[model samples]
Target: MSPNRALQRNISFYDATNPQEALGGVVQNGSITEANFLDILGILLVVDGVSPLRAQGRMSNHIVSRRDVPLKTGVYNIYCDASIQISNEPWIQRLVSRFAYREKDTFRREISNRDRKCVISGIVNPESSIQAGNWAGFKAAHIFPLEREGHWIQYDYGRWITDMDDAPRSSKISSSQNGILLLAHVHQVFQQYLISVNPDDGYKVVVFDLDRFGLDGKILDPLCRSPDDPHHASDELLRWHFRQSVLANMRGAGEPIFEHDFPPETDMVGEILAGHYGQERFDLDITDRLR
Candidate 1:
């Protein structure tokens, strides 16, 4: 199906107390207005994907409420439904990575030093291995994607990086405060927005896609969230990512899931220009490539 068509389906909401009574449908563009109770409920209900059976189950078990939605003022407990399959489209990945490109040595070194293990999984990299300069199976994942540097700059998101000295005010996208050490595979799912950490919810790990790694509902590592730790990841950045994940996976039919494995000789530029957000993606790609 086309990306636009895949995102046009309606997301319905029903009363949890009486599942038979319909509350309403999601607003246009799948945005759930914060002020509207039903809209908030609808976002909570469908953010994890459109599964009537699961939605019904949650309501039946009182796992979610209709009249008294327990969501905090700005906190959201959202995830993409496991059923919304991710696509194997490598061009989109290339385009996004191009925008994310920067001098990696500093960011990677600082993040790896601070977070010696995957923050979510707690898989520690041995000190000996690190001394040998072997950082296999782990990566520094950005909380606010580097691809969205334009958004970051426009909003002055660099102000949130209080932990870093000499951090670039123009773009703190590569700062350790905006990064988390994650297992390589976990990093992929994170970059895809299929999983995210909800800092407002005590940094609980929320999975929008299938829980293949059993990471759903896990709390973020304390080592990374300790208040005394100057290098802790930014709560603002985490919240931003959580919100982005909600918009990407819960809105409408959910954002297209693009794969990241591009074979050699693939016409990545052509594919990106032909896909959703084509012009924006192409422009970002070109601008970043030029730099």
Candidate 2:
């Protein structure tokens, strides 16, 4: 059987951090660690259900060594091991309600005006509906996530924000260029890193989880990508988000998947603190929400 087919057949047993443990029976020649294992898995995920030739052409730019190499070869050559390091970083997503920022309304308005729809689902927001004050089921999601504002500032990620006039002086994390309009459900998946747009692959939407929204392989909406539009979402930010998604879902054993829904009177904080990387995540969530 072909290597790809062999890997696919035993995908359930595959472990990202220790590939040799699971793939030893199938791939006997080389040392496959988390680095190469994730690279291979990423290619498989990107090319799943896609024709080889088409996927190759689409992922050409991601080729590390030879631009002419086959899609699989190129993907295997690229070092995706950085994702492993990223997965170990102190990143966290906020689950509880956050303190409202005064500038958030302006940020939402700017994003809604620029995108005018769910960029992933292509669901349009009609002007008539807006005039009637019926704006529901839509949200402006932060690509970098508000919970990571500390990291954003420390890393000076605000340098990528070209449209910053509307952002608050304290931080450019609220820039419209860092936001995207998405359906309420789509927003949830995106925040959880279950879905992402691969900018290098012609902005193709990649679903890391079950594609219940029929969004896999869909192109990002052009409305949010026009070069002439000053408020268009940043490709740099999109790329960062895509990498995060890959690490969260493709790394060995993958990052811990948290349950966001809480029952009434449940100790949400206590539960979160008791989960994986709980103390760090809880601390970050509390710090950002109160800011």
Candidate 3:
């Protein structure tokens, strides 16, 4: 099946110290020790949905080239060990892998799990009412969207740099603490504010502008909500990312802004929706297929 190479991660060995490092060059000399190879194989199975033996088999030549005894069975052992370690703390690994695969749905789920409601309005609705039955208030937002070139290779003094062209594509979905959960409407407003108010800062979305616009974009102080909310601050690194990738479009007026979370409590999707609103977190009762 074409070696099922498509299912393998593109991580490199050089950046292996971190869980989210690229896997492209990491499978050095087309090889890894039997133990390490097994670890990789298992990781592929668990993280990418590949069969354990099949994943190892794909790396047969590489393992043979680099190690003395590169058996798929041995490799499977290593793969299992790595899978256990990764499963214990999966957010980072999941983020890295999701970014690597451009699994947009995974990205949305991760963010939703972390912060389930829209901070803009503070209203939590049922998941069914949120994104037209997607989630109460969850949508996949690109810290550095593929539509725009949002990928980073490494950090330079607590800042991410886009130097790794080969590695850049692997980082498409690496989650940053700087990223935020907003209603789709607020997400759109945040982008518009990026172009109109903070063009100087580049295309990255920032809390400062949204905090200024509030949920509905009435130009009220956006930070009127809890200032201590971790998402309230600007992320310099993400801004740098946007600056590198976001192309300024000095074109027609953008979409309308959702300027008011007047109800004072809302979910991400509720913020996008309009009409008489209330404060309640519904059960969503969504089917598995919807999730």
Candidate 4:
């Protein structure tokens, strides 16, 4: 760790035993005094730099909703409107030395180059503004996971990538071609297969029952919408992801509890409603209002 790390950077570390559960301890309750925040980090971490600028930036940028302010900042107030996320900064060179891969990898940067921002949200800029020096908040999620059941490449899930019969498998199963670049929240839904892209149609999204998963279907962009983007997600990985989603959402009777998406007419109604109100709300239900 650097001398003034917490003062200048947002460092996210992983519990290598389980990267899925990593960084849950990130303090989302706004900034705290350096003393109250000391004991929460892992034993190997050194936590002492909750200075004004870091807290101010985290507050003004990453905070979702303003609440009771625990730490006193006489000059500036930190209020976050989006889900708290770690951004890159000059002061961010600290970590578990061995877990450097947790930092945005070459795979993620390549995906980001292709996808730009969260395809669904339609926001071109990050909340804090993408400073020339800072990294993006988008996460690169692997369609075929590298780890499962605390083991890598050894189990049934691993077999799906290595040994599936009908679908062609990628030689580099963990490459950028086997991934999707998504916002943090979208990544969460994508992780569960609540959101997916149709392999047949120009990669248009087919969200499976948004209501059941606490998400709403939106016009999500595929990885290869542009004319000249060299990299694109592999059909094999996407097929695997979609299959896993079906398995994940299937009921005990071996059937999906809900259908894949709203009908095209329903979407037409949604579009009409959105245009009429001059606002694109996802859950504008024609059935509920009966107008």
**Which whole-number lDDT from 0 to 100 does residue 128 have in model 4?**
51
Name model 2 segments beyond 4 Å from true: 1-103, 165-170
lDDT of each: 0.61, 0.62, 0.32, 0.39
Residue 200 in candidate 2, Cα distance off native in Å: 0.7
For candidate 2, list the clashing residue pairs, or say none.
Answer: none
- Compare candidates 2 and 4 on TM-score and give the better one: 2
The parts of candidate 3 lying over 4 Å away from their true place are 1-103, 126-137, 150-169, 176-178, 194-234, 238-291
Please give the lDDT score for candidate 4.
0.39
Q: Indicate whether candidate 2 or candidate 3 has the larger lDDT.
A: 2
For each candidate, what TM-score against the reference?
0.69, 0.71, 0.30, 0.40
| Window of ten residues with lowest summed lDDT in model 3 | 89-98
User: Quick one: best TM-score, which candidate?
Assistant: 2
In TM-score terms, candidate 2 sits at 0.71
lDDT score, residue 270, model 1?
78
lDDT of 2 by residue, 1-291 (tens): 101212322222222444344311112111222333335344333322332211111234332332322223222222222222222433345442333222388888888878888999999889898777555999888888786777788888898888785566447888888889899889877877878887776787877665667887688998988889987889999988887776565544455566556678989788878887788767766676676
**Model 3 compared with the native: what TM-score?**
0.30
Over 4 Å off, model 4: 1-104, 126-136, 148-171, 212-219, 222-228, 251-291
Q: Write the per-residue lDDT of candidate 1 for residues 1-291, one digit (tens) a residue.
A: 233312332344443444453333322221122223333343344333454322332323322334323222221222233332222222222233524545388889988888889999888999999999888888888777666677778878998888655767755677878888899889877877767787866687766665678887688998776778887899998887776665565544556665335568988777777877777767776777776
Candidate 3 per-residue lDDT over residues 165-222, each given as its tens digit: 3433445334423344566655554443332122222221223122334332222123
Better of 3 and 4 by lDDT: 4
